[model samples]
Target: MNQVSSSNASLLGATFMLGAGITFAIINVITPIVTWQMGVPSTAVVFWQYVIATVFALPLIWRIGFGALKTRHPVAHEVRAFLSALGVQFFAFGFASGVPVWQMVALSMTGPFFIIAGATIFLGERLTVQRLGATIAGFAGALLVSQIGSEQFTWASILPVLAAACWGTVSVITKYLTRDEAPESLTLYMLVLITPNHFLIGLILGIAVAILPAGALPASLATGFDFMLPGGDALVLILLLGLVTAAAQYFLSLAYKVADATYLQPFDDLKLPLNIIAGWLVLGQVPGILFWPGVLLIIGASLFIMRQDRGRLPTGRSPIPETA
Candidate 1:
């Protein structure tokens, strides 16, 4: 609908969304190989990804200068960054745990539901009929994808669900911050703060691991507490990760600039399939059958939520960690 489309075909927006999809698919595919296979710590990967992104953003930082850092909402920014960094860590852990890419991506779609509920609870927004229904449907979809009672299900399988909740809470906080904070301040604060938050969390975890005996924590939990920098092929993949992360963010900016979110919803959902296909091709991971039906419901709920939320927030500004 032109209600969301800025132009006839919304071609530019669709193209940018597609570009983001491809890059995110690459990120989803490679993260596991770096953590699950190459044995890089998940926290290290999360820290470096933001560090690399910060490095990439130096010019913009320099251009904006220190004045952009003067925000009254410093604590809010810190909390948001903490939550966001944790979401990134959880996502990496899920990937490292070898959850099928499609399932992870599909489950991540539940973020919108949390966002909606948070808006109603925290932001004092009304929960309309459509959004309430969408939230239920979305969670139902997530449950199907999760397959809670299936033998294949494990604690690691739920990490992305936790990630979705964290990301959604961050989004709600972002919405609250937007009431007063400038966009530049928010972006600058996030870039500057996320890395340190990640490092601190990693440090605490590493300390805990050291204090505890061997086998105290599970392999997935214990794997990423070290301070090691990746080398050789792992280093190259992480660098590629940094590059694509920036590219995905850029594409999101471009896409959101043109098409309103409701119009771009379908294109954004392409990441699920793109990640799924990439996983099958590169990692030989086949999605469980639940993925098909689960993804459909998730997509439907996301579209409905986006449609209902069309004008409440800034257009094209996604708080979900689709780029991360």
Candidate 2:
């Protein structure tokens, strides 16, 4: 990034940033369609999505070879990979439970707060007053966005927030492991291990679904865990979902390669509005009036954090990796 002039690199990174935001927005909109409208189980949706995504990521893994697997923190890699897989599952389950696309995306923004909190407790990282205040506001914003006491709120609303926490914790561990492990090693470990985590978890869910009494669980919890892919157009949509997931990750990597993470923070925030618009246009999932207050706090707090960390964290070193 330092090799290129600031203006040129920032422009290039912004372009990729836009591309990534667009792709993830597409992902957000398509997910609920596949899980709810199409009747495919969320378990199967997450499983196959990662499998197809791995297929898209194969070329990079091949280029890097098994050498990328060499790491000083194998256990940490496994834990992070598993948590990332779990995060994807929780996000899928949110859609399956009918959380509107916009709301889910909004809740996902709480990740950085979790990362900061986790870093402070687990990594002994400093928690500045500004960061602590931002973290509190971020969670407060999440609570407002969640609309806990409103008739619209459901237990499902927690899933996206949980997903964010999972991914954020993954980022925390990545911060620890990256002290000695290469970034490529982390990516390689994720690509190789995440799908198995998905598969194993899916299998367990399938067994539980089959064996658990019919009325034992809530209606939402009782949704079948399907191992089979959906037929016809649903299959096509899931395939596209995987392809775009890889595309989003690729574009994010490109953006970080060319420009600083702080420089691209504003562009990253675009995902919230992009997903909101996509939900409104594609699914008529308009966010309620309360959504604005929460979203504002989240974006504002994130921008404030980025400003504070400008020279400290540096490029390619942001704790919140979207891919994680």
Candidate 3:
């Protein structure tokens, strides 16, 4: 592609990614509400979302043919799928546990720092001073969100941080696979592998809840396994959750195809502010005063990293090293 075309494609990819981030933020806000209304466990909700996403992607799989499923890096795909599933579980647990939307979003910002560190340590990418500074600032923001030395500090709050770390690992592995794999294939295989895993776990959790006494299971598991059949509006919202999540995943895959992870990482912070707006508009929940400063630091740090990384690569081209 010519320079103009490349730039346009990158712009398009960035736009899609921003839209995906917004969609994800919306999902983050709504999932808890739906779970509360239906009294269903987080695992059940996650299982259904993945099933719907898998069904939605069936057409793409058919068009691409069975050949798209063939990959020499099966083990890598397996590992990535596992991490992705674990990340989803953590996110669901965190949200269902009643972590505030803004706080959850802030904690999730730790992913970019994890991505930078993973890229440097695992993928042999350079650790620039700007990236190091950004990572430090990002963690500082997370600490602020955690409200250390305050009454809001709870062990349950750590789930989103762990989720962010898992996602960061997934991001680096994804960058590695993208060197030789199609984005569609990576996404398809991940869904194909993780969907069943989530479904099985949900089933197990449901059975455990049915057979075991309430106090026997861990509180998080107990809360996440509190399944109830949805009716009316709750059912509709659950279906929408699946659809939105699927589309967001596809957009993210496309974004990574057009740009390096570093270039795209900053935009992930968009979800924080988006979540804040969503909470205010939909739930009448405004963040505490400390949230504003922390969010601004996170965004400002991300922008600093983005500015430092730009112009190092040509427009619309990925910075990932080519593979054999």
Candidate 4:
């Protein structure tokens, strides 16, 4: 790719990433509320969301055919799907557990740090001093936002952090796969793999809820495992969840296609503020005093990492080597 074409691609990728961020923020806000309102289990919600995404993606797969799906890295796709499923399940659990949207969003800022760590460990990327410092500061911020010393801290608060870690692993694997795989193929295979996994998990959980004694299971899991059929507004929201998720996933794949993960990762920070606004408008929730400062630290850490990378790379391209 020439400089001009690369610049254009980067611009397009950034736009796609921005769109992904926006749609995902909406998803973050709406999915939990929809799950709670409909009394659907988290795994069930994930299953439907992916089922919808797979349905929407089938046309593209039909156009591209089976050849596009061929890859030497089937194992990689499976691993990515597993990690992504774990991340999605954890996130859904966090939201359904009554953790505030903004707080969940804030903790999710830890994702980039985990991404950096994954890149370093798995991708053979070097960890610079600035990156190390930024990662530490980012975690410190997360700890502050967690308010562990306060009575408000609960195990539920940790779910988003686990989600972030899983997502970060997915991001690293994605960066690796983008070396040879088309983003569409990667996205398609992931949905194909995980949709069934989620359904099976949901089914098992539903059965457990039916068989187990009332006090046997944790309250959160019990509530999350309560399977209910959607109706009325809940039905509409369920359908929208699938469509919105598919769109978001597509945009995200497009973003990774044209740009390195490092180049696009910073744009993810936009979701926090977006989620904050969405939380206030849609859910009437507001962050407490410590939330703002913690968010700032997280954002600052991401910027610092970006700046360090910027100084090392050429003006228009990433220094990170692409694998063949």
Which prediction has the highest lDDT against the true structure?
Answer: 2
Q: lDDT of all predictions, in order shown?
A: 0.79, 0.82, 0.72, 0.74
lDDT tens digits, residue span 244-264, model 2:
887887787778878888898
Better of 1 and 2 by lDDT: 2
Error of 4 at 30 (Å): 1.8
Output the lDDT of residue 270, model 4. Answer: 74
Q: What is the descending TM-score order? A: 2, 1, 4, 3
Q: What ranges in model 3 sit over 4 Å off?
A: 2-7, 126-130, 203-220, 223-229, 254-267, 306-324
* TM, every model: 0.91, 0.93, 0.83, 0.83
Worst lDDT 10-window in candidate 1? 315-324
**Clash-forming residue pairs, model 3:** none
Query: Given candidate 4, what's the lDDT at residue 230?
Result: 64
- Against the true structure, candidate 1 reaches a TM-score of 0.91
For TM-score, candidate 1 versus 3, the one ahead is 1
- How do the residues 160-194 of candidate 4 rate in per-residue lDDT, one tens digit apiece? 89988987788788778877777557656765677
Assess candidate 4 and give its lDDT. 0.74
Model 1, 304: alpha-carbon shift in Å? Answer: 0.8
1-324 in candidate 3: lDDT tens per residue?
A: 899987987787778779877878778877878754455677777777777777886765576577677898999988887777778877877777877777877777677688788988998989987789888988888788878678887776888889888877887888788788876577567757878767656777778878888898766577544345466876787788888877776677667667665567667567667788887788677777777777777777767766776665322322111000
Error of 1 at 170 (Å): 1.2
**Taking the tens digit of each residue's C-alpha lDDT, what string does model 1 give over 1-324?**
654454644889899989989988999988999988987877788777767766776765676577988988888889988988888888888888877787777787788888887888988999878788888888888888888789877778788888888899988998898787776677667767777988988988888888888898878777537667678998888888887777776677668667777788888888887888898999998878876787788889988887777777665453333333
Positional deviation of residue 296's Cα in model 1 after best superposition, in angstroms: 1.0
- Residue ranges of candidate 1 with Cα displaced over 4 Å: 1-9, 212-216, 316-324
